[model samples]
Target: MTSDLRLSRFEYGFAQFMSVMASAPAKLEEKPKERTHQTRDRSREPHSRSMPFRNEMGSEMVDIYVGPEEEPFRVHKQKLCRRIPYFDKMFNGQFKEASENVGRLPEDDPAAFDVLME
Candidate 1:
């Protein structure tokens, strides 16, 4: 037989073998394993939540001076970013405010900023 004919026969045999293997049923183990430890009730367990305002003291804070009065306010950078996209960009983006950790808003009302921070 020629090399091409031999190769074709081998390929046909391989394909048939693969098809048979693919069609075979999967076998399960005869024995089952037991749990090593007891499962505890997770609902009763104490868990820490994202209480940003309550836990702000531990995190990094940013100083913001707003309005013509330049009324100063301090806020947690992370919590501020989470609620305000403008602050997020200003504090995270390649701006002077980001590096300084300080923001000045001469045009914005301090009362409005206070409401937002609260």
Candidate 2:
């Protein structure tokens, strides 16, 4: 089995591989092609009206109360939705949390939530 594997591996010899690599360009020298689509000037639009959920822009914040004491933690809704599946469902779905923009986890540890935020 080992001999068969070795025979297959040697089918393309090291010399042939090296020769091909040597003939190839070290780096591509082509200039970047211009974008074909006309991008809308975002500067003219209001910041709040812009794409809020995009990674480059900051989204609305949400308040999540955790632990027995109900320690409140403020986090970006977009970040939470993008990173955590539970948050994504809760925020986007037809749930009370989506409407209120607040979440409660009375049993979950506040420290764990803090770590998650970090």
lDDT of 2 by residue, 14-90 (tens): 33333433433322233546879987778877777645445542568899998899999999898877666567667
Q: How many collisions per candidate?
A: 0, 0
Q: What residue pairs are clashing in model 2?
A: none
Cα RMSD to the true fold for all candidates: 25.1, 18.3
Measure candidate 2: CA RMSD.
Answer: 18.3
My TM-score estimates for the predictions, one after another, are: 0.52, 0.53
Report every candidate's CA lDDT: 0.67, 0.67
Candidate 1 lDDT over residue span 38-93, tens digit each: 88677765556445545764488899998899999998898876655566777887
Q: Which ten residues in a row have the lowest lDDT in candidate 2?
A: 20-29
